[model samples]
Target: MAIHIIDEANRCLNCKKPKCMEGCPVHTPVPHIIQLFKEHQVMDAGRELFENNPMSLICSIVCNHEMQCAGNCVLGKKGSPVHFSSIETYISDMYLDRMKVKTAEQKKQNVAVIGAGPARMTVAVILAQNGYQVTIFEQQDKIGGIKQYGIPEFRLPKTILSRYQKKLLELGIRIRPNTAIGTTLTIEDLLRDGYASVFVGTGVWKARNLGIPGECLANVHFGIDYLANPSAYSLGEKVAVIGMGNAAMDVARTALRNGAHQVTMYARGRRIAASSHEMAYAELDGAEFVFGKAIERITEKGPVFKTSIMDENNRVTGYEEGEEQTEADSTIIAISQGPRNRLIRTTVGLEGSDKGLLIVDENHMTTRKGIFAAGDVVTGSKTVVHAVEAAKKAAEAMMRYMEKEGA
Candidate 1:
């Protein structure tokens, strides 16, 4: 089974200098882990991956392989790139069945991480491993922020998220759900209470609203709200997604999954520029796209909505122009952008952009010393892996600061 899997894994030319690792935000050891699996050392492979990424299992299933590790594989130059994700998943599954040993001794530094999302989870794990008592404060009742709420069941099952949460608990990281940082307990309280340091990883949950006329109509809703409460609205037979980004793709695909007869995506950019690889997968899954156009307005017509499209110059380019007004049970706006600013302002004294994203330095540190921010909050919006990577960097920086102060 191992040899068959190895041969089937697609041989890597194994570039003299591997670019695959460079392409990964978390810098996972791609080729080495694959080689370990190829050699039938599945447990070793799992250990290798775990050393770099705590969320490997979740990522192996959901990551955009085309844009990351596998996309940069030199083997792609010949025919197909190595099936890194599949191989990684296989190794992870095998190791998960066995009893793996912990490699580090626990220490005693108290660290508080805000937001139970990917970035905060990563920081919590690393801090715990380094002998720190890590406590995560999440406003939501559950640990996984967007992963639990924003993403749908089909792509990322709740079971997978629950499993990761279980792992974090086993690692000695404390998760305080239903606890909002700025609301339940302020940063000053955490500091005064003797936390050595606090890392903020609250993701961007605020949806960007379409400023066009008629957006506030009862028939219109933001994608986040729609995904957050799928049972609340009766999705009409036809629906239109107002963006071509991944979130837009997610909204469109989700609409289709919920029984919408037709789903269309509107993008102001070309297909290549607007859609991500995951979005392309969404396209293959039956979401249609109308590239290079923007929705100008939405007007409710009984149970339907009439939408107008505009060109780059803001002139009316097209519409359901004369076509029977499409009955839209709900017009979803997937274009809102922002980080949770209240926490940032209260904790770190950092200002957000007009768009509400936190400003950060190259080290992923905010303007406030001893405080760092990452993930969607810092990058505006990005993939889960990107958030994990940013969190890892922030954790390392925080560790260095703690060490300096201790020394």
Candidate 2:
């Protein structure tokens, strides 16, 4: 059963400014939605939320609410603020089954949405509802890009993603799975055929490597490779994870659950890059952390690190003389991610950053006309909420472009 709505709804306070909304990346209407839930307008509340984010429940689960919406609550100044995201999530999960999304009767224009990730999914949902015939093209056989591949089952199960997929199909959005944009079909092919606009949300799947010795050892794995295919290989007992972010923590916890006896994480900086809650959970999960150590080299036996302090400039300072070695059968690097430019290189006139991130104007339009890009592909690795915000902005811009250049 869902939590009691009355107690939480009554605590909203419904301020005129609503700093919760202001702090939100997608600007979710917390106060107004709470007001609707308070009045027993259950379906109406969900609809109002979908008006902004189609994936409200998923966001509620993954989002760091204590840092964003709940952080800015006025009542938090005096006491504990209303758990807005949690309340919204409970109400949404309850009402989603009862509510049916009403899409446009007529589907006229066609828009090609590349990658079935969060950004593109948001774009497809918004465009399809507005009478644009949206078709999604995913390189992988399955949908839900990072949500399906990177996020663990404990965090977000595949069953929840399937529900979102069903809604998109019902909204008149078509999809072509196992079809890559560059290898199978190029963006020009879609434009030449009938698609009025092309939106690229293909995120970074390539993981960065630690340019050190013995990197080609047998059990080495990139963070994405390990997460994307859990059954690919046995991580083995005594695993070493490199980095200090959410991905690193997730990898450590995942390895621990997968029968790895001990998972230890190493970071160059003393500060934890991931959310404090996640780090706490990792610690509880029996994962060890060694900070202020830089990996000197990765030998077949394990990784050798040099103890040091990271300066304000991120340079190695206070370098210790001796080397510290951690014995491990496997090493998982979760350092960073760079954009894959295979598709962008094939599509002429689409400019990108030196880092290979797709370059876009204020309107989310790429260098090439009629082409737009968003998500991690456009801005490197960022939050899902930031990607959704960019995609929505792109959707609005496409709507204007569609009108100006009639399909």
Candidate 3:
């Protein structure tokens, strides 16, 4: 089912010096893993990937290949790059059933991870592997965060995500879903309860508003809200999505999937305007685009909504300016933004940006000692791989700090 590996593994010049590894964020050994796959050592290949990334399954599906790993492949300079992502996917799928690697059970220290997202999960896994008893407090009823709720099943299947999650549970990571850290339980409380360190990975769930007039109208909704609860509302015959980012594309594609007759994505920028590669797939799924135009206003006319558009400099432009109102039954706002900092406000000595993401040092340590933050809560919405990298960094830093304190 994976495309990259099925195509490229056989074509690998098996370069003596592979540039693909050099381009990876965590520098995963690409050539060696491919060699293992070619040799039918699928489990070994999966283990090699797991050595650098615990969220390999999720990354395989969501990674921006054209930008990372495969993008830098020397083979790509001449021909199609090795299908590294598909190969990685195949390795995970074929071997995950046989490999029974569990977290090391040494019980050396205690760490409290907030939010059950990728960052929290990664920190918990690393800490657990090092014999640290880790407790994860998640605000939601389930783990996986946006991956479970935000990403559609068509893109990321729940079975793959569940398998990856099961490995964490086998590692003895304690996940307490429906428990919020800065609210239901404070950081001070976690420390008082004997946690050596606390890592926060609460992601940005609050959607950004367009601040236009008709936003307060009945059918206008945040793209996340629609994606998060698809069955609640009918996407109807026509829909206008307000942004060109991945989320906006998801909304448009989702609308099409839900049987919407037409879906149009509006962006103030050009066609290359999308922030991620997933958006390209969404375009291929039949989502239309209205680029280089911004929505000025949305007014309701009878049962439909009229959206006015303008150029970057506020000059009237788009179909709405020429007596052709962009009529849609529903308007989905997909402008990207940050989290609600209600929790960070209660923590002493902790500060956030004006945009409301928690500020942390290179080690992911907050201004407050014993507190570290990662993932979207700290980085303002990043990829699963980035969150895993941050979590690994934070876990190592926490371990060093604990050793220094003689904990």
Candidate 4:
């Protein structure tokens, strides 16, 4: 692995106008980081990466490089792109353990981060680094939110998140795991308790239903709930997966791993919603795909799919007259998810969009003053890099807000 990374690093042209950086959501200084690696300054490269995006290591593993950084590499037009993801993982994994986190002079002001997902985790780190007292409230027993529950373990190991937990603790950030903010402790309660600013990054956890008949049947399961704990389900050898997004791919692959012999995914249109890399891996993992099949409803036996006719652009134009029900032991829905309304319902002055997502301004401050938001709650479910970028901006805005208020 070291030799491969070195070879890839050497292949970099070190462009003055690096397209890779532009393609990156967080605008990672790809050329400079690679130059640092080439010059045996691996720690410096890692520090720069972590400073720019606190979730650099996690993003290196989970970010859609095929659509972002590596996809925009100039070499990719002719051949394979310089796989910066591998190099980044190498530097970050090394630096995470050894690098010393320095904080500003200790401040008395406190900040509350609602949710321990990618966005709030970034906020906590940045605020803690600036010497502000920070506390994270997570609904789960552990952190990582979607990184822990939504994404499958084969793609991103849970141990990396565990290491990040230790790092956050070292930064003097307090974590209140399994404590949901909306139920007993409201946002209003936090503000009253001397929290200068509150950041809400509670991700989209509500599983979207098909609304069709037989959805409540025992044989049917939602993707979000299943990925959170695949071991809990007893999906037999023949598992029928609904939807074709990245999460659908994960479900198919995970089902295969958990003793499902035949895993097939159904897509509404000819084109799938998942990234090519993920789709390729799912195929490599022996998951089958059937396109142009719109699920009408799920039955106790399996999902009933209607034959969808597509236009030239692969859009679903119409569906055939009848539907066909396939045989499967279980049906899993992976059509995506929406944010829950618990926080907004419980908190006064806070507003959410029609979709139940938090309403935030340019600075990421929500409708409520001094309460900021980012990540999936604001922009729907997106990549980890986007969450980091959003949280960095929100964290800066939060500091300015606190400073102006004399907190």
Candidate 5:
């Protein structure tokens, strides 16, 4: 069923305005890149992609293209849309050299980037390209925070991260993996050690707690715990998921793959936080979707349910009484997350939200001078592309700040 994507590139109508580009958060010129690929200029195509999105190959592979570019494709009105992700993946992989930037203005300032997640990755690459020294401190041995840990291998393979790892290492961006910033070093330490500025993009690390009776039991697991190490974690045959989001969907699908005979997903909201396509994919993988009802409490036997009614505005009206108790061997709490704030609490003058998100001004600078933050640390669990865009904003802000300070 695999068509020669390069040949399929010729099918692009190549819209003048290019809604695909407009629809993209990063504003990648999709039609133009497709044109380059169709003409057999993969290197040229890669350069175009690199101008906007640095993680072209990985994003093309994992991004919800159907919701963005492919969805907006004019051809999608009637016929099939152009396979942009496949074409982009092809160009990025085949001509990676084109994505490499050989020249940047020697800014000569050391910047400390905490966490090796997508936001940090974007900031690191941009700052390094602009001739600033970037050092990333990751708590875990592996980089690519969410991409490396939270995601399932079936969706984004480990090989993709390995390729990116090699590329990042080659960029002369120093990385200290397996080193917790707050424990090993502090924000004051980075400044004292001559890092001109520090960017805190540690991301959302704390999983929301499910306040239920059986939460402390052996078979219960949080979304992060389940998704991070699916192989090592003890799974169950009849798995019950208690949320609806990207993480929730991932848990349900992952459970099905890892010997769970039946995966029952429960969420109270009318709307699922996850994209429809992702939910569909989970459903295709044999996950049982249960909406509008959720577990009020959990017991050793199973979950005690209450049917939640939603208004037209998607707000929960009230829970209808029901004696619904579904039997399951294991339960996974796949709810939202917040910033761990271990490093932030220790540091002085860094403002934060009620929900543990870091507070920043128009310039992406935190309450503390010489320190900036972006991504989920600021916005609380957003998509990878959104994180990248936010990083770009932070990077630009840093550039202006550094210029003012004459670093």
Candidate 6:
């Protein structure tokens, strides 16, 4: 593994104008990190990675390299791109344990972080490193929000998240597990208790329903809920997954792994929504994909899909006449998700979009003055790297706001 990583690192041309960095959502310094790795400055490479994006290791493992860094590589137009992900994983994983830095002088001001997802974790780390007393309020029993609950262990090992928890604690960030901010302790409550600034990174978890008949059936499940705990539900041999997004691919593959012999995915349009890489993995796992099927409703047998009429552009123009129901033991919906409104319903002056997403300004400050937000709650569901980018800006803004207010 080390030899392969070194070989990939050596392949980097270290472009004067790196397209790989430009393609990255958080603009990770790909060439510079590669240069550092080649120079034997491994720790420095990891430090640069973490400083630019706190969840560097996780992103390196999970981010769609074909669509981002690797895809944009100049060499990839002809040959395989330099696998920066492997090099990053090698450096970041090693540096995470040995990471120790002297923080600024401790301050009396406190900061409240709601949710322990990538965005909130970044905020908490930055706040703690800057001397503010940071406390994270996670609704779950542990941290890593989506990283812990949403992603399957096969893709990203749960042990990595456990290591992150240790690192966060070592940074002097206090974690309050199973304590939801909006339920008993409101955002107002945190402010009343003298929290200088509050950051809400509670990600989107509410599954968007298809609003069709038999959706509430016992045999049917939402993708997010199922991925959170696949062992809890017993999907039989014949499993049907609706939607062709990445989450749908995950559901199909996970179902196949958990004793489901026949797993099929139904797409509404002619083209699928999942990335080619994820789709290939799902296909390689013996999952079948059926496109041009617009779901009308679900039944006891399975999802009843109507033939989707497509235009010249392969867009779903409409649904055709007949409907067909495929036999399946269970059905899972992987359409998408929206933000939960627990905080919005409880907190006055907090504004949200029609889709129930929190409204945030350029600096990630919400409608409420001191309350800042980022991640899926603010920008809908996005990659971890995008959340990290937003969190960095929000953390800086929070520091400025607290300092100006003399909190």
**True-structure RMSD, every candidate:** 3.6, 1.9, 3.3, 0.8, 2.0, 1.0
Which of the numbered candidates is closest to the native, going by highest lDDT?
Answer: 4
lDDT, candidate 5, 62-135, per-residue tens = 88888888888888889888878888887887666435656376767899999999989988888887888889
Candidate number of the best TM-score:
4
Candidate 2, run of 10 with poorest lDDT: 1-10
Give lDDT tens digits, candidate 1, residues 1-407: 46655775547655667778888878888878866766777888897787688777767877787778888888776777776877777777666546343526665568889988888888888788777888888898888888888888887888877777777777778888888888768988888898888888888778787677878887788888787768777878778777776677778888888888888777654533333667667878898876545456776841223455666665565655433344455678887557767866676476677777777788777776667788888777788888888888888898888888768
Segments of candidate 1 deviating more than 4 angstroms: 1-5, 96-106, 272-277, 302-327
Q: Is candidate 3 or candidate 6 better by TM-score?
A: 6
Error of 3 at 95 (Å): 3.1
Please give the distance, in angstroms, between residue 363's alpha carbon in candidate 4 and its true position after superposition.
Answer: 0.9
TM-score list, all predictions: 0.88, 0.95, 0.91, 0.99, 0.94, 0.98
* Candidate 5, pairs of clashing residues: none
Error of 2 at 212 (Å): 1.6
lDDT of each: 0.75, 0.86, 0.78, 0.94, 0.85, 0.92
Model 6 over residues 1-407: C-alpha lDDT tens digits?
99999899889998999999999999999999989998999999999998888899999999989989999999999999998999999999999888876578998889999999999999998988899999999999989999999888899999999999998988899999999989999999999999988999999999999999989998999999999999999999999999998888989999998999999999888787688999999999999989899888898899998998899999888888988989999999999999999999999999999999999998889999899999999989888888998999999999999998984
Candidate 3 runs further than 4 Å off: 1-7, 271-277, 301-324
Model 2 lDDT, full chain set: 0.86
Error at 176, model 2, angstroms: 0.7
Candidates 2 and 3: which is better by lDDT?
2
Off by over 4 Å in 2: 4-6, 105-107, 310-316
| Model 3 clashing-pair count | 3
> Model 3, residue 142: what's the lDDT?
75
RMSD of 6: 1.0
TM-score of 5: 0.94
Query: Candidate 3 on 1-407: residue-level lDDT in tens?
Result: 54546556777767777788777777778888888888877888888787788777678778777788889998788887887888887887776666676666575668888888788888887888888888888887778888878888888887876786677788787888888777767888888888888888889999988677788888788888888878788767888888887777778888888888888877665644455666777778888877655676776631222344556765556544333357788888888867978677778888898889989988888989988888888878777788887888888999898888764
Error of 1 at 182 (Å): 1.3
